[model samples]
Target: MRLSLISSIRRPGFRVRPLLGFWHRWFGLFAALWLALMAITGSAVVYYEELGSWLNPDLRQVEVINPALPPETWLGAAKAEYP
Candidate 1:
């Protein structure tokens, strides 16, 4: 089957409506500002996790104990609950 691009083909004599032209221009400004805000916020959100880790030292802090918990302790607890 052959697909037609009839609607995409521009008709030679174009009629421009005055009110529509005004509306387009009016909405165009708002659309541009909205897109700009989206771009800025999107970039900020992308780096937000990395920035948070860098900014908050408490979140990055790790408690160092002399010895780590033995695997037997976790295995015994798991067996007690699951078995």
Candidate 2:
């Protein structure tokens, strides 16, 4: 009776064409979301160093030249320390 009709619709090997379209649509939607996420994160990584320096400028500062011992004195220290 009515059960036979419902069984035929739900039978094995029955092709539901609309579900195929829905599957493809959802796949495309998720792919686009993944792509957008990658693009945003990629941009953030590319600018990470600049962003860090800007946020903490004190850590990126260069001081004026300071007086130092002569090269001979540095070489003597190096010889004593390394050799």
Tell me each candidate's TM-score.
0.50, 0.53
lDDT (Cα, tens digit) per residue for candidate 2, span 1-83: 89998987796876789789999999999999999999999998999999999899998988879877899999999999999
True lDDT of residue 11, candidate 1: 59
RMSD of each: 10.7, 6.3
TM-score of 1: 0.50
**lDDT top scorer:** 2
Q: Score each candidate by Cα lDDT.
A: 0.85, 0.92
Q: Quote the positional error of residue 66 for candidate 1 in Å.
A: 4.4
Query: Which residue pairs in model 2 clash with each other?
Result: none
Candidate 2 regions with alpha-carbon error over 4 angstroms: 1-14, 62-83
Residue range 9-80, candidate 1, lDDT tens digits: 645576558669989999999999999999999998999988888889799888887777899998999999
